[model samples]
Target chain A: MKITFPHLGNVYFAAKALFDELGIEYVVPPLSNKEALEIGTLYSPEEICLPFKIMIGNYIKSIENGADTIIITGSCGPCRFGEYCELQMNILKKLNKNVDFIVMDVPSDIGIKEIFNRVGKISSNSSKSKKEKIKALVKALKIINMIDEIEADAHYIAGYEKNSGDSKRLLNKCKRDAINSKSADEMINILSEYKRKINFIEIDKERKPLKIAIIGEIYTIIEPFSNLYIEDKLMDYGVSSKRTLSPSWWVKNTALSPLKINSLDIKKASKRYLSLCIGGHARECVGEAVIAKNEGFDGAIQIFPMGCMPEIVSKAILPTVSKDLNIPIMSLIVDEMTGEAGYITRIEAFIDLLERRRKSVLFRS
Target chain B: MYYLGVDVGSVSTDIVLLDKSLNVVEELYLKTKGRPIQVIQESFKILKSKYDDKQITASGVTGSGRNIASFLIGADAVKNEITAHAVAALNIDKEVSTIIEIGGQDSKIIILRDGIVIDFAMNTVCAAGTGSFLDRQAERLEIPIEEFGDYALRAKSTVRIAGRCAVFAESDMIHKQQLGYKQEDIIKGLCEALVRNYLNNVAKGKEIIQKVFFQGGVAANKGMKAAFENALGFEVCVPAHYNMMGAIGAAILASEAVKKDEGTKFRGFNIAQSNIIASSFECDGCPNRCEVIKLEENGIIIGCFGDRCGKHSGKIAV
Candidate 1:
């Protein structure tokens, strides 16, 4: 059976590598874009969040491409995202699309046996032995971690690269080459080579570029298309940017969160502002902003889709954080109607303010 | 030398000229009326007739139509309305702690501490407490927009008007009028309602400190200013050039941005005669289908933007 899943930043690379290793036929739906949003909005409920609509569009596109089995991860948070899977399934059923869903909830929530059963549906298709199957999973995990590392390196080093756009060019070329690789091993090898190459790129040591932390909704922060490729824009401005949320980070955080041992520092940092998981990544967003200030970041930009309930709460709380930390924070609320020019103008103004603040005599260190 | 600043809003286009020390030397306010380009050119023509183009060292654009205006005038610095307002307010009063800027289409509250922006909030996806709403209500009441504030000031007592939305406010006003309320009372009630909406939404959770400054097109309404003061229990100072503050701030920023050696990018007054064509086309290269906007100067493409992927924007220099 041809399987498919919605895009989530670099998670597609890991999924592709795993499917390729397992010899499972799968369709990776095209990247989320205006067409997907239009289709999704047309079919979705008026008040539902942006990510839900985008995912629905991805499903329909994959279904049209002959994907009969859909794999989706599940969550039980207070955020509306947890409810998306059920609603999406109903929508597909109503549309008369013939597809089977394999939802992989946390083992604790769905039970270990059920988790294995869902995973086994796909692994069962592979003729490889148990050892090879385990190795393939390991390889996929390694690839995701490496890719995230490479991305973080490239984003940070873009500011200090001796040659302008060197890091950006390398990052783009690496992704393109990896995606074109025929085999999983080749893809992994390509990523590792690029990962090593990123470390060797010549970087200027004397440059004092602005360092900013990106904090907000996980989906909007990770997905370049959602945030209008803000990180790339920051790179172009010769500004160092760092985001704590990544596909690999999500995996690790989810795994260790049930044990009450995940992201202790973020939890501690956010305790003063938001102690509880107010559903979604509001706590993380707040925690990251505070941590960013302490880490010597010049400023932070918080981006979330318009009308995101959890992020709205975070937006209200961010002003207090900005005041207490004495760090400039700008919250950009984006929707389908968001004008690109206005959005860029705000970013440029924020950068201009940061530069002036840095050079001002009053705030000298 | 002079620095020019242009503030292009939905309802008005304001242009200001500032000397090297940033003193406002000349200013013009005109109705935008859905035509930013023509209004800007008209303002430039008036300025060119009075001042020498060679003396204008640099130019900046701000407000909603900043991008289009910047492209049209070749502004050295392009800024958002928020920053421009805050800068202009601080310039007026170094100790200004709060700025309530209610413009044609949007409203914003800037909270400052020690001459720096500490926190701020703007009205979200609503136009209930802005100048356009007042203009519409004035037209419906057959009152000239300029005299609407005077009518509110003449009221002895106010009648309740829902200010949460323009629709509800209009219906409430009509309902009050039917209940035998005077037009003056209804106008006053509307002003109070708009202020209530602004305080609850835009200025919610913000500390209303002393030395508050109110600047924007809506600041011209003494009734609204009185409503703000009455609500906050503090005096709100409306700058002399309240409506032109954005333009003044843009000029200040431009003066700071351009160095003597670097020179200015101002396209010159002759650009007013050039045929600037703006058009958009959807790029089918990807699923994004980004509707890229292109601006041509006398048939040659000068600027292209709006592509999420820099496919088209990268090719165009500006």
Candidate 2:
């Protein structure tokens, strides 16, 4: 039996660990790529949204690589994520790919005992008694948490610092090694020591310097091509970026996301703006930018899916924010036609202009 | 140091010429109605009267209809509306945290953090809160589009009307009108209901914070603005070029792209006003029913793209 989770900035490490710990045979697809987008784009239907395309890409890549089964967290929600597993799995089958997907739709109203039950359904390990299964699940959960924390930090640090840092590098290596660890203590130890180093570091400026902040719809931000492997390309140009949203945020916000209710403030905001009846992320983006600038970051690169209304609002509001804060801003909208070259060139210039501005600020100060 | 940006969308084509620094030097708002090519030519003709094409250093294009605009005018940069809108927002106020934009066919929310887009959402299926919807309702009532907001503001009482979708919104507005509710009151109610439907459906699960600015053609409506303010419990700002923000954003992106590319793609002002041929064909590629649009200038295949798949994705020289 094998198991896998979707790749965020880093969940591959845990997949390796769970398979090894259970003594279960498994395989993970290579990191996502341009071809992944091409394949996914060809397969996915329009109107489903962007993240769906990328996730479909990841699954297609994995199943095509001979994986027998896939595991995805299940949810029921207002965010439309609850339906992803069923829809993506069906799409894969429609594409005539054969693979078993163990979709564990975690009941929002339930607890982690369900996790053990879901685990038990697959493993003969159920013979080991309930306590044993609980212990294993708990341990697995801890490792998952550690991997998530590391990934979250890596993304955040990458946001302020530059491309692949000591933290991100060490986290990747440590995550791999920890995944291969023989015991929970081993994974914990590696995770612990790694956390010890994530905080004490800074980017090597003389090495190279292009920095950007990636903030937008969760669909485009994490996916490689939905927005193009923008982070990778930026790194190719020696640019480091801070991407604020991640699947980790999805996991983190899982509990709080639904409870975020419509309030008087939303109504008031609607009146204040376009009396725009719906689509709300524009304001959150503004708050996020102020927060980034306060953190002493250089500039920001914004990305969003085409025809995404909430994001359009953010795009409209950001220019003023850039001016008042003295930060350079680049907003990229991704539809099918957003050629990578055109997007990347914009990034290079934005970075160039920002660097010049930073240098001048330094000289003046 | 004048720079220009053009936003050619499904319903309208807007243009903005900015200084090198992206300040608006000239602006054009023309109804695409149905003829994008003709309107663009007319826009150029108008701009030519005021500012010589020589003074324009760069230009950019954005929106759903931008492909033809870019191909026709040799745009230095071609960007989606999201990027253009975000850039325009940042250029105006670096502290702006949110942007709310509603056009004829759609509405969007873009969230910015320190001039970066941190979050965004868009409403595509519904037209209840969009400009075209309002335009239809305005016409049905025999009220001028420009006076819709003022009429809405005069309402002392609002009769609740359904605005969940275009069909419902229209019928409900008419029903209320038939019931003899004051025109002003019905208009106010229509704006409020549309605002409510938008917040309930489009902004459903997102966190909408502060420092919001309203843009797009629909923003010209004062009653809608009031409704938005009432809904969010906050003041919403409308930029000077609210109607042309998308175009301005395109212009900003164009200027930045030109600086990066060392040249402009704009085919020069004279050619922007030339003849163009456009058509579409169905691709039997798979069962997705993708329709690929083909555009040509004279006889040259300028560009092609659409919703379906690779059927006509490969351009065949005819």
Candidate 3:
């Protein structure tokens, strides 16, 4: 079986490592771009969210590349994401593209045995021994964690880099080197070397840069193409930005959720605002905003797709959060029709607000 | 010597010339009519007839078409309308605390505290609460846009109209017209409805403190001014150069940038006669198919942009 999956930021890198080490055939669809969006928009229902449309594009592109199996994670939450698989399957079937789907749901929802059965569907295609397959999984996990750490460090150091664009240049190079590695071990080595290089980059501690936290829908915030590469723009503007939601964070949260030990800080921070899991990481978005203020961030930006129910609730609560915490938060809604000019204007104005606020506060002191 | 500012907006292109004392010496507001380059070139020709290009020290461009306008004129400073508007307002009145700027295709609320902008919000993906919608409605009613505001002032009692969407607002107006409401009352209701929509959407959750300066092309509408007063329960100050504030701000910013940079990048007013051609083509390098814009002057490529990968865009120097 040639496995295929939708793009979600850096998850594909780990997926590549896992499938490579497993000796299993897989097709990695080209990076999300205009073509994928056009194909997705052509087939998706008019009112569905942005992520669903992009995922459909990924599936079709993979199908074109001779892939016969699709592996996707399933969720049974209050959010519309839970119903994505069923609707997508029907859409693909109507298009006459017959492909097998292996959904890996959480153990709590589908039971551990069912989870393994789904996993075995893909592993059965690989001739590797059970121990070797487990090693591959472990290596993939390490790769994700390392890459996330390296990315986080680069973002934070961007504001303080003595030489402008140093961190960004290094980070881009690291990704290029990591993705080009022939094996998982080579990728890990490249990641670690870049991580050290990023840490050692000359930084100007005296330079006070505007710091922002990115919080919102998982798909919009994690996927760069979906949000028009806001993080890249921030880096270019010499702003330090952080986001608590990432593939590694999602993996850790899922694994430790049943034990009631996952994201304790976020849970506590968000308790006063959103205590319940309304699904689709709305609670995490709220929590991250509160934490951003406590962590001395200058401001926060929340991004979500248009008509996102959970984020709409979070959007309503964010102004209160901004007022209560005395932190500035700007929410940007994106869809297929989002204009770049308007988006850039908002971001620039937000940054100007933050910069002027710092000056006025410093003047008072 | 004078400083020049140009605001190339979606609906109109505004140009301003400020003397050494920072007072506006001349200003021109011309409809863009879907041709920004021609409008800019025409404005430059007019300015050239009056003053020598060497008399201008620096130039700046703003609004949605700032990038292209800046490149076309060799602007020293290229700034967004928000910053340009804020700078212009703050320059005009230090005590101004709120700015309600409604322009063509975009409306924004900028909240300032202590002469510094603290917060701002712009209308999202919708032109319902903008000058363009009002212009369209005025056109549909066969009333001169400048006189539409006066018609609103002539109304005896306001009628209720939905202003959430432009299409709905137009249909509601038609429905109200069919029901025998006076033309002035329907217009007055539209003015009020647009004010309500602007407050609830663009300026949502914003604290509108007094010394509120109303600016932009829509500021010319007396009915909008009255509606804003009725909604906010305070006097709204409209600057003398309300329609050209973005351009004025651009000029002020360009002057400031010139002081630091010690030289202007302006190509001179003679550029109006230059053989400049702007065109675009679909890049076939990848699946992105980015429509790369290429600018040529007398058959020599001057600049290229709009490519995501920078493969085509990097070929030309700014």
Candidate 4:
């Protein structure tokens, strides 16, 4: 059985590592691009959010490349994402692209035994011994954390690097080397080496760069293509950006959620504005904005897909946060029809506003 | 010597020549007619008729077509319309707190505190409250666009029109016309509806204080200015050169940019007679199918852009 999965940033790296170690045949669909979005848009419901359409495109592309098993995480939350699996399955069936779907829900939602049963369905196809399979899972976990750390450091240091583009160049090379590694251990080594190198890059401590926190929907924030590679754009502009969400963070949050100690800092930060979980990381988005302000970030940018219900709530509340915290915040909504020129203009104007606030005597009382 | 500024927008191409002291020396506003290149060259031809190219110190470009316009004219400074507009407004009056800009295809609200731009918002995913919609409504009513404001001013009573969407607004206008409303009153209603839409949508949640400046092509509509004043319950200041403020700002910026330079990057007025072409092709290198735009000058490929990969974005050596 050839397995496939949608792209969610570096999650594909972990999936590749696990599948390779398990001796499972898998087809990694091409990176999310225009063709995938076009196909997905043609088949998806008109009102569905951007991530769903992109996922549909990924599935179709994989199906064309001989993938029969599709695995995706499921949520039982109040968000429309909870119904995505059923809708996608029906759509694929209608298109006559037959494939098996393995939904990995949280242990509390699906029960531990049921979760393992679902997991065993995939592991059963592997020829590896039980111990080696466990080892592979552990390595995949390590790979995700390492990659996330490398990416975070690269983004932050880009603003301080004495030589412009050093961090970005190294970061790109690191991702390329990690992907091209023959084994998971080799990938880990390459990642560690690059992490060390990025830290040692020459930085002028006296130089102050605009620090922006990226807070928004998980799918849009984690997936670069969905948000039109905003983080990369920020890096190119020599702005330090931080995002609290990542695949590793999700893994840890899911594991600790049952213990009721997951993301306690974020919950406490978000308590004043949003006291309840409105679902789909709305609370997390609010919390991150507050956290960014408290951490002395210059501004925050909230990016989400058009028609995103949860983010719409966050967008409404963010103006208040911006007023109270005295931190500038900009909300960018991305859809398939999002024009690049308008998007760039908004970003440029926001940056100009921030810079003028710092340097211009016009703001002096 | 003069610093030149060009604003190539969707509907009009505006050029302004500023003296060394930043006074407006000459101004020209020409219809774009969907051909910015031709309009820009025509402006240069007009400039050449009056003064030598050597008399120009520097040049800057702004508006929606700033990139291509800058490339063609060899501008010393290129900036987005928001910064240019804010700069021009601040230059006119430092105490200006709010800028309501309604251009041909888009509208924006810029808020300033203590002469510094603090917050701003632009119309997103909709063109319901811009000059283009107003022009279309005037055309549908068989009224000259320049006389649209005069018609609104002559209205005996106000009529309510939907301002949520352009399509709905048109249908509502027709519905009102069918219900026997006077043409002038309907035009007045449209002006008010558009102002309401702009305030609610583009300027939503913005803290607009005193010394508000209204600019852009729509600012030419006296009815719009009056509607803004009536709605906000205060006078909305429209600058004398409101329509060409973007070009004025661009010229001011160019003068500042060339302060340390040996000379201006102005390609000279002779470029008006040069052959320049912009063409695009769907790149087949990847599935992205990016429409790569290539610019040529005198049969030589000058530059290529819009490709995600760097493969085709480089300048081809002559």
Candidate 5:
């Protein structure tokens, strides 16, 4: 049976997780590029959002190579993702390609458990009892979650200096090792050992001074699109940074939060065990900023979309907290118009602030 | 004397330290535990334990999170992963015509003109065919992620799986399994789906050139490698440090930045002592609800971020 992932970002994480559980093999779409865009734009109707084009393109890419079934998540939110299954299905049918589809909506539409039970229909009947199926799924979820966690750690590492390959080599090795891991316990061991092996060179204490924290919505935070690549912008200024949250962290934190809710955002940010704050991870994120300040970071950054509502609310509340906390904060509202050069100029000045502040503190101390 | 590069992506942060001669010195792969600060702090602690006395000359930061890192650590130079990755690839194998990258959150295809990124496209929206997707598949099968390729290799006939997206892929896998397809066949089909997704999404517009180099975490999958070869009708080369190329790229850029800059703002190898603060303010300055952030240390504003306008002004910490 073939397995696949749909959509972007955490979907990758989700796919990894699902596969690792079932002990199955799956393929990855080619790196999305101009060709995929062309195929998607050509095949998918223009009226659909850009994501659809990309999604349809993924299916054809997989189908051409001999995939007969596709798997997708189910959503119920107002966002277009909720209807993605229907849209994608119609688009595929338009192409007249006979393929089976499994849309597993995460948020739940009709019933969560019932939808999940559909798994019984796929594998051996008696061989797969409810307990066994759940066990497999749980295992898969764990692996996927672990991979996501690793990816997140790597993002922060990306902010550092070293040959690009150094971190990637280590990360890939870690991922390969984790994937081939003997068991969950073994995976944790592999990750811990891997982490122990990393090396982060510190600048001359006399010279090395400024530290910043970057927080924001997932898209702008990770994707180069909405934010116009804020990471490089700050790096140009010579400031080190701290970021909050990654898929890996998100998953692990959720799994572990029941025991320590007060420490993690899953508890600090909302009533739910998970981060249901929408974009408002900002509230807890700002709290993290306070924590960072207490830890001695120089400043903080909030990255998000121009019109993102959850983050906007966070923006509204962040300043008052900033004033009370006495921490400097920078908020970047990005869109297509936010160019590279503009971002660089602002970042330069921000670094200047950090440098000057560091000098003053040095003099005072 | 050496330079270092770190590509901090959403899924993971990669650290690659290279000598002035461009020899590999040290490498690290870390999971960002909701705290990039902790990741760096941990890295520094580990690094100090190993090579605190080494004469490190320069460093670079790249990837989506580069700006945050550059400021936090005083990165010498900041470069884009595409440029850094392409540059490093060319340095390793100049003849490479195409570069494929599949990280945790996104996928990219870079076409080169004499080693420069003349054309590129990325799939930031879909997760159908990324390393993470494969990991999920591996999880479902209860197989080690590394052995996904082995499973694919054993498949006599692959039951096609649609990897259009994660949601579809998962459900489809379940369906195929219900159809009573062998696990190996399902896996092989899944491998083909990844190849299909990659080609259709990111590689569609561009010509499949020879001398293609596949990097990023996904390159670890042998099934994917074979699928790529089968689909493209050519061999795809996986870089030795395929996953860390972005970090290496940033390091290359950092090496240049250190040479170009005079002073360093590194917070020392013991950045553990440095304080970091993040806050937000919605800019009533306009209808745009811009939340500007200010960074400071010892009661002094050090840097600013999260503003769309230049309204929030200060010396940037990096």
Candidate 6:
């Protein structure tokens, strides 16, 4: 069976490594673009969120490229995202596109046996032995962790690099080279090599660059295309940025969440503001802003799609957070019509304000 | 020694010259009419007749067309309209607690306390309460845009017009006219509807404290200002330079930037005579197909942007 999945930032790299090692045929749909969004919008319900439309577009593109089976994770939720799989399947069926779906829902909801059965469908396609399959899974996890580490390091070091653009160049080159690697092992090796190079890249110890934290809805924050590559822009401006969410982080959080042991610090930090999960990542967004302020970030930027219900709550609460903490926070709600010039101007102005606040002692203690 | 600020928006291009002491030396407001470059050049020509280019220490650009403005004339500081509006309001009154700014294409609410912007929200993918909507209604009514506000203020009674969307509002206005409502009442109804739209959509949940300053091109409409005052049950003050606040704020930012950097990237006034061209093409490097834009001066590429991957932004020759 040929399998396909939607793009979510660096998760595609891990999927490539996993399928390749398992010796199963899979198709990685093209990275989301305007064409995909247009196609998705044409077929999707009018009120559906941006990520759903983008995912539907990815599925259609993958189906055209010979993918007959679609694998997606499932969420039972108070948010609209939980309803996407059913709606997407109906739309695709109505369009007469033949495809099978494998939804990996949580064991608590679908039961452990059902998960095993679903996962077994894919593993059964592989000719590898049980021990070998486990090894492949471990290797895939290692690859994702390594890549996330390399990316985090590169982003933080971009601000202090002795040679301007050194970190950005290396980070971009690393992604390009990994995508071009002929084998899963080669991709892991390339990522590790880049990780080593980034760690050793020359950085100025005396330079103090403005640092910011990116916090928001998971899909918009992690996906570069969705938020207009904000982290990349921050890197270009020689500003250090930090984000706690990544593919690897999501995996760990999801796995340990049922045990009530996941992201304990985030839960503790968010207690005063939002003690209960109100659906989606609203709590995480608020917690991250508070954490960022404590960590001495000059400011935080909260980005989410337009009309996102959960994020709208966070957006309202963030002003109180900003006022109480005495930190500046900017909320950018983006849609297809978001003008690039206005978005960039806001970011530049925020950076300028941060710089001025640091230099002008009157504004600070 | 003066700092120049230019706000190139969809409907209007505003320019402000500020002396070293932050006093407005000159202000020019011109219709953009879909030709930002020409309007900006026209304003510069008028300014050139009064002051020398060498006397301008630094310049900044703001508003929707800021990127194009920065490319055409080297800007030392470029900011967003929200920040610019807040700065200008604070400069005018340090006690100002809230700023309601509605421009040509967008409207925003800036919440400030102790002269710092704490929270803000701009209309999302909607332009129901902006100047463009008012301009369109004015055109349909066969009334001059400047006199539209006067007609609203002269109304004896009000009519309700749906203001959720521009199309709905227009059809509702036509329905009111069909019902034989007076022109003055309908205009006043539009103003009230627009204000209600702004309060519900843009300033939905914020606590709009006292000392609110209304600034933007739309602030010229005394009717809208009065509608805001009526809805909020508090006095609303419009700045003297209401339409030019963005430019004034940009000039203030430019002054501060020049002091900090001790340099200006201002291209001489001769830039109006230079042959500069801008164009865009989709890059096929990846699936994103980012539409990369290039600015050419004398047939040589000076700036390339809009690529999310920076594949083209990095390739530009400095």
Kindly list the per-residue Cα lDDT of model 4 for residues A208-233, writing each as its tens digit. Answer: 89899999999999998888778877
lDDT of 3 by residue, A1-365 (tens): 89999999899889999999999989988878777888999999989999999999999999999998988888999999998889889899999999988887899999999988988888898899999999999999999999999988888988898887788788878887898898898899999899889878999999888999999999999988899888877886788999889999999999999999999999999999999999888899999999999999999999999889999899889989999999999999989963477787788878878887877322100
Superposed model 4: Cα runs more than 4 Å off: A360-365, B282-289, B314-318
Listed per prediction, chain B TM-scores read 0.97, 0.92, 0.97, 0.97, 0.91, 0.96
Clashes of each: 0, 80, 0, 0, 184, 0
What lDDT tens digits, residue by residue, belong to model 6 across residues B1-318? 999999998789999998888788899999999878778777877777788889989898888888778878788877888778888899889999999999998888888878777667777677898999999999998999999999999999999989999999999999989989999999999999999999998897788998999999999998998899999999999989999999999888887777777688888787666677778999988787888888888898777777776677773111
Candidate 2 per-residue lDDT over residues A1-365, each given as its tens digit: 44444565545555565455555556665555445556668888777666666667777767656676777776554444566788888887887877777766544544578766776666663345556555655666666677666655655555345434444455446656775676666777888887777776575545434456777666677655466667644543444567656555555545454465433342343343334433424554555565567667777877777666677777777766776776666677776653333354355445545655555311100
> Per lDDT, what order, best first?
3, 4, 1, 6, 2, 5
Second chain of candidate 1: TM-score? 0.97
Q: Write the per-residue lDDT of candidate 5 for residues A151-202, one digit (tens) a residue.
A: 5455445446344334445655675676556544566577667766654432
Off by over 4 Å in 2: A1-365, B283-290, B305-318
Worst lDDT 10-window in candidate 2 chain B:
B309-318
Q: Which candidate ranks first by DockQ, i.e. highest?
A: 3
lDDT of 5 by residue, B1-318 (tens): 667677777667888788877867799988764566567767777777766534566767777677667766668776656666777898898788899888776677877645454445555335578777777778877899879888888889879898887789889989989989999898888889878888886675466698999998888888888888888898899988888898887777666565556754455565655666655676665323445766655456666766543457533221
As a whole number from 0 to 100, the lDDT of residue A139 in candidate 5 is: 59
Worst ten in a row by lDDT for model 3 chain B? B309-318
Assess the local accuracy of residue B240 in candidate 5 as a C-alpha lDDT between 0 and 100.
88
Which residue pairs show collisions in model 4?
none
The candidates' interface RMSDs, in order, read 6.2, 14.1, 6.5, 7.0, 17.8, 5.9
Ranking by DockQ: 3, 4, 6, 1, 2, 5
Candidate 6, after superposition: displacement of residue B97 in Å? 3.4
The CAPRI category of model 3 is acceptable
* DockQ of the two-chain complex in candidate 2: 0.02
